[model samples]
Target: MMTTIVDLMVFIIGASIGSFLNVLIDRLPKEENINGRSHCDHCGK
Candidate 1:
C-alpha cells in the first residue's frame, strides 16, 4: 500500500541521517574540523 511505501521511505531516510550523525559523533571529538579519522578517546594522539 501507499502508506506502507511512505513508511518505508521515511524509515530509510531517517536511518541514513542517523548514520551520518553517527559518523560525525565518532569523528568530531577526534577533530576540530569536518574531516578527520576517528580515534579512541583515551589517547590524545
Candidate 2:
C-alpha cells in the first residue's frame, strides 16, 4: 500500500515536469518568452 502511494506521487510529479518541458519544447522553437500571458501567434494580440 505504501509503495502504491509512493508510485502515484512520483508519477504526478514526473508528469508535471514532463508537461512543463513539453510547453518549453513547443515555444522555444518559435523564440517565444517562457513566461507571460498567452498571445496570438499571427496578430501578436
Candidate 3:
C-alpha cells in the first residue's frame, strides 16, 4: 500500500513536469520574449 501511494505521487509529479515542459516547447518557437505573457493562439490576445 505504501509503495502504491509512492508510485502515484511519482507519476503525478512526472506528469506535472512534463506538462510544464510541453508548454515551453510549444511557446519558444514563435516567441520573441520568453518572459512575456502567454495567450491563446486562436484568440490572439
Candidate 3 residue spans exceeding 4 A from truth? 32-38
TM-score of every model? 0.69, 0.74, 0.72
lDDT of 3 by residue, 1-45 (tens): 999999999999999999878778887786645566777789979
Error of 1 at 37 (Å): 8.4
**Every model's Cα RMSD, please?**
3.6, 2.0, 2.1
Candidate 3 Cα lDDT to native: 0.83
Ranking by lDDT: 2, 3, 1
Highest-TM-score candidate = 2
C-alpha lDDT of all candidate models, in order: 0.80, 0.90, 0.83
lDDT score at residue 3, model 3, on the 0-100 scale: 100
Who is ahead in lDDT, 2 or 3?
Answer: 2
The alpha-carbon deviation from the true structure for residue 35 of candidate 3, after best TM-score superposition, in angstroms, is 6.2
| Residue-level lDDT tens digits of model 1 in 1-45 | 999999999999999999889888877785655466555558956
lDDT (tens digit, per residue) of candidate 2 on 1-45: 999999999999999999889879979998988896777888989
Cα displacement (Å) at residue 5, model 2: 0.8
Poorest stretch of ten by lDDT in candidate 3: 30-39
